[model samples]
Target chain A: MSLQESGPSLAVVGVTGAVGQEFLSVLSDRDFPYRSIKMLASRRSAGKHLTFQGRDYLVEEIAPDSFDGVDIALFSAGGSISKEFGPIAVEKGGIVVDNSSAFRMDEGVPLVIPEVNPEAVAGIRAGSGKGALIANPNCSTIICLMAATPLHRHAKVVRMVVSTYQAASGAGAAAMEELVLQTREVLEGKPPTCNIFKQQYAFNLFSHNAPVMSNGYNEEEMKLVKETRKIWNDKDVKVTATCIRVPVMRAHAESVNLQFEKPLDEEKAKEILKKAPGVVVIDDRAANRFPTPLEVSNKDDVAVGRIRRDVSQDGHTGLDIFVCGDQIRKGAALNAVQIAEMLL
Target chain B: MSLQESGPSLAVVGVTGAVGQEFLSVLSDRDFPYRSIKMLASRRSAGKHLTFQGRDYLVEEIAPDSFDGVDIALFSAGGSISKEFGPIAVEKGGIVVDNSSAFRMDEGVPLVIPEVNPEAVAGIRAGSGKGALIANPNCSTIICLMAATPLHRHAKVVRMVVSTYQAASGAGAAAMEELVLQTREVLEGKPPTCNIFKQQYAFNLFSHNAPVMSNGYNEEEMKLVKETRKIWNDKDVKVTATCIRVPVMRAHAESVNLQFEKPLDEEKAKEILKKAPGVVVIDDRAANRFPTPLEVSNKDDVAVGRIRRDVSQDGHTGLDIFVCGDQIRKGAALNAVQIAEMLL
Candidate 1:
């Protein structure tokens, strides 16, 4: 029986990693069509077993031949792994949707947010016989732009200042476990086990662990800056970001200040965001309820609140917003799956 | 025995609250001279016993006559308690160093940050046989200004943007206990206990619990904006803030962006902060170490790091920095004690 009879054959690289596992969950949740599936991971996890949609699968070591017959490949391993295997998968006639920073800034590779810039992957399809590479923006950038873009379209955003309260899940599943273990140890009057991070991760927060660039912006913060420019396709838009890792499990919250080229009042900006797709408004001034990381822990939609005019700016020229989104879902797995769906 | 033999007689109001306890600790730590001391609280804690400097003391119920013959009083109860009793203490000839927001914006009260604006209370002395009131700025404002004021002095900051990651101690002792309990409960696969806050606060964060105003800025946020102007004595300075409550125990972290009228490079800003009193520089780019709340938990000096030129602005006219300071130490009790020390 031909695997392509009902739908495309699929391969999931880094199937044992955090986002890799999430990719499978998102695919199953979305009921993505697949005739046959291959689970690929590093040599250490090659013999592991995983079940998806009541079907059992044995993980295989990733090799050059892994993508030989694959139609669409989802890559979520670290950047170095993606760097080594991404091109090979494409060369093997598999369309690659990568969740690493490997080729996000590559000139010819289209960095896409399906909700914001679906047209970036205009003609690429699973059955087109031509293999293509699509890069997923960084999680902070994806979560920020998901809320900022709808308003950016209504009034051109000239500058944006973002401060992120990121979650442990952005680091990986192991880091989330480390946080829990550390919290338990600290509560018991024992020194916390600091395996995933160098310092204490429970009941504490710190700057992002990404390496600091020469300009003093960490890799994580610069990703927000550069990815916003690329995804919006507007090089003139200016951005600055301060990324912090909080102790939350899986969701991220950002405080964004936007300076626009045109006047956009708070009421009008709220109206625009209300009609925007994939965005939920939780702003209730009377109830004092706004979007929070815990409230959006496992949700797919990005929540935006604290909508108000920037009092420091000239009348109606700037707005301040708070946003929360599940880092592993909309920020990573769900975003990549949406890109693959566009290809179908 | 005359109680005024060595120094002024002192009174500590709200002696059972978190900041109130910190007040006693700081006074003892500083070897503050006091001939007589009174521990006063509400009726709920009237019979409570507290030990200070190896001496046992009973908490007395606060009354209008509680301030009689008292040379200085430190108030940290809620706003209404301070509003009703603060002037009463002053009327009884005791100088009041208030840690509440009751008189922060009053026309005659001098809002003081000892490190930044000690001169505002030059003439108010504890033993002048005259009563006075001094206001301590909010914790978020105190932490932000500790780092920003030095740069603002050199380059004349025209606009400032701040985002805060606050701790549970700002809500009081019960809130801190609630956070610990909720964390333990959540780890045990049970619903978290939600008492101090309406939502789960373990491994999660939310916007500040301050009442949201009509303009969409919460009271905690407005305090930062308004207090900066009052403390700096700069009515024209533009300030905006977003206040968030993180799961941290005691320290508050702030990300501040400054736009200055004069050009100030990152190096110069670093030099200025290095010489600024009550501020420490922790900007180690190679080690990827910046200020974190855990590192600053009980520290008296505010830690500043992540200092960089704002790429979004032109030619050294703007910069960004991250700051962390203990909410109870430098933010509240320590600041009030410093104000009282100035009166000596």
Candidate 2:
């Protein structure tokens, strides 16, 4: 359990994905403890070699026996694959850190963000050998709650209404390529086709986060609602989201309207956010300084700005803030690796 | 009011702006009957020529005497110019349709949208040139209420929460150029500058729409609240808006959550929207056919989709709908021209 000592070996599943590539890069950049590294993915990706830490390793097709000698496994494959193979990896004595939403809300599993809840990582029971599958919250949820959670400690977070401008990377590598290609086509005087998304992805914006449920809310919207509650541990924290996909390449930007139980001011909000673990506050409106997707795309920390007092509701104090984070970094890979770092 | 019979002439203020150019284009394309067209702008843009209807008209410097021989003047200029010259035009016996927020909520001035409130156009009372100014609603309000006003006829619209993906065109010509330049810089492997917006507009989204008010809401949010009430002729519609600027060019997208006094269904919503003038419902999820920015750009009607029942609250039906319309067209110029058409 000591990261100080040379730590146990690590395995990264789906190492070719946007998030998976970020995981490998973050691990090497952060110099996270590991005696050895293993790359795993589907059969088609097997035998493909990736270079990390000046060493070349071949990817092996993920199977039930893939985690036999591995100490920790990082998962970024699709949800169905994670749902089917996650418990099996756990069964083979590998502690699984899943980036998918498969077991996030399970009664027995622990959803962990090391910065917010490192103690939660210890709840992974040892004897279960279905080694603990630690769930990582969604990208948007992690970026938002990182700023809001610290404020909630001083005052209760009553409700949050978020509108997200998500990047193409969140949809995976091919979709990102589609965005780039479609944009190139549009610039070249051609109409971009709709294949990866319901609408055109070049120079366009639409509501394609997830399919809307029978409740008139899309799956992506519901995830922001449900995951925020799970992360903040407050079901009464009302959350409403209108998630949209924009033509951005990397960072996911969210405009969060939060109503607090107590009054919050600029000084207090800045003071709290500046001290928060993974938050950076950049609120200078006169010079027009605030976080944008390009500024936070490759960074580890969540960039926040436009932090000011809510003038609409007089009696019930509120704070209006904007947050941007690398969906592939803190939103996905860096967070998963951070959770693993906590356990080590 | 007769198209064939001309009194004096017509003038267009702010003729070089995004909405202004669109006004010129729509007028020419629709064969609007203007005996003569006087183009006006600031002293800097004076002496330029705007080609319309197979004729080139020299732009004049905006001043008090600019509307001397003008019978009808359409103002799509900023608030300051509208406030300064709208009355001047009205003083010269011109029926002024101001596309700015200057006279929108004035006590005696009428706010008109031809489709939703044609009665308002007819309701223009006989008065001196002093009270001749007519107000146009905000872009977001015009788009949202166009889709929702029909529903309100069948069910009371109790509350509405909207999240807008506004295009660069809403912020004027500089913003549009900023988006294009910033995007080009990003594609060329350079860090773009942030001037027109608070953040980098290339592949970045920021939530500072209309200035941020003291109460946490931005001017854009408050405008939606105030404009919707005035447009619907209801003082108690209960509107909440979170407006964010995305990296799109012309059309603005809105995700609306509405709660009605009575139960609503997807089929009924679809029917009402289809029959409503200036609205097109493209709600075939199975075929992946929904309204998108590219599809609705340069079009007059508001395109709506993602309609369903709200499963979260019992007896309180919910709907998720998207609206995309060219902010310059239906949101500004065409709407004003359509109001003039109703007057005729």
Candidate 3:
């Protein structure tokens, strides 16, 4: 295929992984304009062939020279790889939108969820003379803030309690495959294969496999607590989360309880969310219909439902909601692509 | 088989149901003394045979006269059946331990968890020649309070927020078989059967199927809210809950956040739960192991783990815990059987 040679050149890091493949899907789905595109991966996958945008491209192993002429780079490799190559790509004059935790909390890097904090990357653009780094928020954090930010803007949230039903996709492709294999093995009356996770992931759920921090909160839960503070630019807003991995495939569901500084009735909150971008309201009290992970598996918008007043809180100062979103779409790849689009 | 004639005459209501069969298992396991036992069910199941304590007995249809000379009766039938037969059993001089929601919130009927509030049934005995009624708490409530009450007793919890991951068994044996069948059908690339629940239950989760009240909380969630206040005899305690149904078979998991009036550190809370009856702590931070539903499938003790100080609250005035217990065993049949043991 011949290149159009009319837009900024792009590079996709970790081109063979789950979120990496999703980046391509989202880019093509949105008809993203690119003059040229480079497929980059680890040394083991360097010679593999991938089809993107009706063009056959050979994957090149990531190296310093890989980003020499790139204008925008989307990185979804693990933290160690991003820690080593994210800066190198930036130093080579490419705007790096990293989908790893390596630079999320760093002061210099802007943690961007385009819908919530697009202004964080204000002066940075593609085809610019200078290089920059923009970090993508964690999958859980992105999905949560998609529904929470609009409400927070209205009543000024004071405290939030979240309980997550996370999917296997958050752990990447291997873990998702393991869940399927384990489910089949369990059904066949054989022992489930227990790779990727230490315990059974077959008809059962467990606390997230993330390393537990010293304070008894797993690293995944701490990401929700810390990233919400950074993304909202409000350190005083209290957040606590309990993250559990269910047997679902590729979407995450959350039960969120919000306490605001001022009164916000459920009706007004629903109106605000219905107008918010990248959010869909599925609250149907009459039909008893609400958001489910399967309903949002491959969709872009986050679905919010179960909108009601928190009876435990005084009057109307509190509201509770249930939200579900595709972990790989809106949570990771689509959000990162949206940030890259703002640069155009 | 001949009657023992050494203890109270017993009657088991709804003997063909899930919890009904479990009631017999728990009775035999504890070697509960019964001079004579009657297996009673609806007319459709009459003449069926049920084996208990190595003796086979014919199931009888429940009627007003079925409770004649019956010292105690355990009821696992639905609310309507219980409402119809409970008063009849009581009028016939039988002490009734009903597992339905028919009389949980009644004025004079005592809702009992043998470990939490045995004294509420004070002066009520099996052979007292007078009949009485007792109600069993909901499964989720029984599992959550089993862990929370110990800490609440020490620090005096003022508010509670709970989110549940409930199993299929809470619906019935038919629902459990449906889950297994739906799982197999889904794996075979066929559509899942959605009979017991309106939504697919193979690898998905949804909000509880309990009817939503005018206040927007479902009956299951409200049960937690109202039962806590009643069980603790504290009208001022505030509680909120979000109940969800997951795909597990016979156990439920709950994530609980509690705010207390007095300061209680995590270490002290652990110490208290360690000594508390019907509670087990499985917190192993280094191993990243916590309470999982599969681990407590048929166990009597409710397992508690992921114990930590709530950083959202200041100075140990709050705590977070995860709990799991068998929905059929400790949550229903075992609990009712324990209440019957108290009568003896």
* Best-performing candidate as measured by lDDT: 1
Q: How well is each residue in B111-131 modelled by candidate 1, as lDDT tens digits?
A: 999989988998888888889
User: Total clashes, candidate 1?
Assistant: 0
**For model 3, how does the per-residue alpha-carbon lDDT over A57-144 read when each residue is reduced to its tens digit?**
9999999899988999999989988999898988888999999999999997999999999889999989885899999999999999
Candidate 3 segments exceeding 4 Å error: A1-3, B1-3
lDDT (Cα) of model 1: 0.93
Q: Which lDDT value does model 1 have at A342?
A: 93
Stretches of candidate 1 off by over 4 Å are A1-4, B1-4
Tens digits of lDDT, candidate 1, A1-344: 22345788899999998899999888888888889999999999999999888778999999999988888999998898889989998987789999999999999899998889998999888967788899999999999999999999999999999999999999999999999999999999999998889999899999999999999999999999999999999999999999999999999999999999999999999999998888999999999899999899778999999999999998899999999999999999999999999988
lDDT of 2 by residue, B76-126 (tens): 878999999998887777788899988898987888778888777664532
Alpha-carbon DockQ of candidate 1: 0.89
Q: Tell me the deviation in Å of residue A119 in model 1.
A: 1.0
Q: How well is candidate 2 docked (DockQ)?
A: 0.41
The global C-alpha lDDT for each of the candidates, from Candidate 1 onward, is 0.93, 0.80, 0.92
Q: How much TM-score does chain B earn in each model?
A: 0.98, 0.95, 0.98
Lowest summed lDDT over 10 consecutive residues: which window, candidate 2 chain A? A1-10
* Residues A208-240 of candidate 2: C-alpha lDDT, one tens digit per residue: 657656565677778888887777777777787
The model with the greatest DockQ is 1
